[model samples]
Target: MIKHLRGVWISCLLILGVGPSAGWAGVDSDISSSRYPSIQAALDANPGKVVEVAPGIHEIHDTIRIVTAGGGLVGSGRIIQMDPARPIVRIDHASGATLRGLTLTRPEGRRETESEAVIATDTHDLALVDLRVIDNQTRGAAIELRNCVDGQIRNCLVQNYQRVAVDDRTATPDQGFAFRCIIGTGILIRECQGTLIQGNRVREDRLVATPEVKRQHGLGQIIKKNAVRGRIASQRDWDRGETDNWMQGTAIHVGSPETTDNTQVIGNLVERAGQGFDIHADHVILSQNIVNDALVGMKAMHGSKHVIVTGNQFIKNTLWSIGMMPGASSLPSRAAQGGQPARAANVDGGSIIANNIITDFGLGQTRWIWGEENVGCPIRFDHGQVPENPPLVDVIIQGNLVYDTGRDTLIKEGKPEVVPPRYRYAVLVESGPSAPVGLHFSNNLFHPGVRGISNIELKP
Candidate 1:
């Protein structure tokens, strides 16, 4: 039986003191210092220890809390060089800790709002290998997991988060801006579960920090400006009165449900980011990623269900690169509509959006699948509104490849809007009365030139 379950998982890690030679008490309790006077006294004299930080610069002012629960803290070939502006390391309430090959920085203005160079909370089985979180001014989410769970943020190299690097929020305030700023969103799983944010390199193009709006007389508006030109670092700003000012900043903002199922955002390389990867979790799995640019490169709103965004690579996002905003309209229309009749009426199910590769160079090369009714205009779903019962549902644009720049690829229905062109096999089936029942557009590949396949039948 697999070696008796690996000898009962190493005898429950030697009764929980996390055995592997319990807390190394050798080499004169090694605690090298170029400047970390006391990172919780070098992790409480190295509990479940293995400290050996050597590569220069180490200036932490406070907050390196590690409440080792089942003991296990190793830092092989270390290099704890911090002070990019503050927040060196703060892994509060720890568990099976493992932070390998470190190198975190942060100088200029000592970054603010609890500056982060590393911050985990109410921890769990954590593991962050091959680390290198650099250039910190305001956000370089090198590592920031709050209210943690079974974690594993592997092969890291989170870069210059002058704003947000790897932040994972828990105490939901509308579940927005969880990992804001930029460096890389290599790994950011919120409210956490069996997490694993593999192979990292999440980059962002600054211009974040716009929060402080409370208007409606209560007055608090701050919108310090940032449509995408610069300076944006505000966290949260509430105002549900609606004016189409629903901001949610991101680079990986997976909030909602303080604990769902097994989470996995496989093979990473998410670049830029004014907004990219904003999943709300629920049996997640965003495989083989390499999303570039950013304005919207994979946004799965609130009611997120059995998710599975396969073989990814949606480049040059300026808008609609893979969206699904099932907000408002009550909610439970099979949990925001998708496929399998929202999973046979159970409500929220469908989400297989398979075999990906959506590219768009710039200037109106839009429409890569927006929500609601799948509006057209560089993509705009929820914006089209619809979902009172079995009303909204029509998403299963199979086998991908929506490459445009040579123009022509508009698929719309209803409201005097009918614009179509790029057709290498068009199949717009919307057989009325509540539509949606296995809407598949089989084996796809639509380049700018076109081929042969047109079967339009709208009118819902």
Candidate 2:
């Protein structure tokens, strides 16, 4: 029966003018610089075809685009972006476009830019498999998918993605948060639905935010003099030139609260990031991920809802291992007493955080920034930006484990000390008008740091 179906599919492809041999024409055909004048020429010659690149470094001066439906590029080749302003590859409005087993990077001078290594926008069934995006420092993401549905970014590697970037949010003065510099991101899924981000590794190669490194890079001088400043986001750190380090990049981020939905982030590894996973969407399943040596292990906020976080391991995180809060877009103006809508209508809650493990809290790369001052927590439920925003509700925190190794950990390069667990509480629930509500905690095993399990008693 399977053979019959395969024959039928082959017949259908033949009827559609796609010969079976044509599909495999470029596979291992040595489409190198000698055969093809440029990679774009090879792609333009073969529309709707899968062109396999040979095993060598290929320089791309212009943006390589895959716009035709069912068109793609694959094979074991390294593409270095010589163009600083453009993405290495852009898949615009393409369906079933696949970029597999390719290494995308940029030269050192071209690294600091807003362009992503591979960006797929308005695509469907886009598969980015076994791709390596390395040493491409940008304020934006290394791999970005926007308005793409049913896409998969699997078995990919994003390394050293964080560059010191300006976090300019000065336009929205109503929020009272303004400009500061920050790091970049690894993989960003914006307004994407039913996306599967599995078996990927996002990591930093070097410590970019250290005092010496920051001085050498002139990290503090990157902020422009005319940049609007209402109130700095991290005021204390901003004064100390430490805001950029603390606000480093997320390894994986799912944003676009009103549009993004039903994302599965499974079995990924994140190391040495600002936030391991910054989730700002709804209906997300974050499972079996390992986040090591990050500022925050994971945070679901910015109007996120119905998120299920389970079976993840967070290790050596300086900030909260797990955090959920309402954001600026949490409530519509009509839903609140005196709320003014900012971007879109959304809310926070209906989330489940269960069976997760957190070890070596307050021992990440940002430990020097935060210090051992009881600054971190295993779990936290916090408030929104404004009092008028609706509170987070209906969250279940169950079966989690917070264990401390009680050993000497690395503070920084050549600084290893037995720093005690710098946690305020195992679980912290903030108290305010917009504090999280309807939170249920049960069967969580924890080792207390400064305070016990929680500041407020939770009902099991």
In order, candidate lDDTs are 0.52, 0.81
| 258-338 per-residue lDDT for model 1 (tens digits) | 254568878878665645677766678888887676656786655566677788887766445666544332244244355
TM-score each candidate: 0.31, 0.85
Task: For candidate 2, write residues 63-127 as lDDT tens digits.
Answer: 99999988888877899999888999999988988888889999877787788999999999999
Q: Show model 1 residue runs off by greater than 4 Å.
A: 1-36, 39-57, 60-63, 66-88, 94-117, 123-141, 146-187, 192-250, 253-275, 278-296, 299-315, 318-320, 324-460
Model 1 — which ten-residue stretch has the worst lDDT?
238-247
Best by TM-score: 2
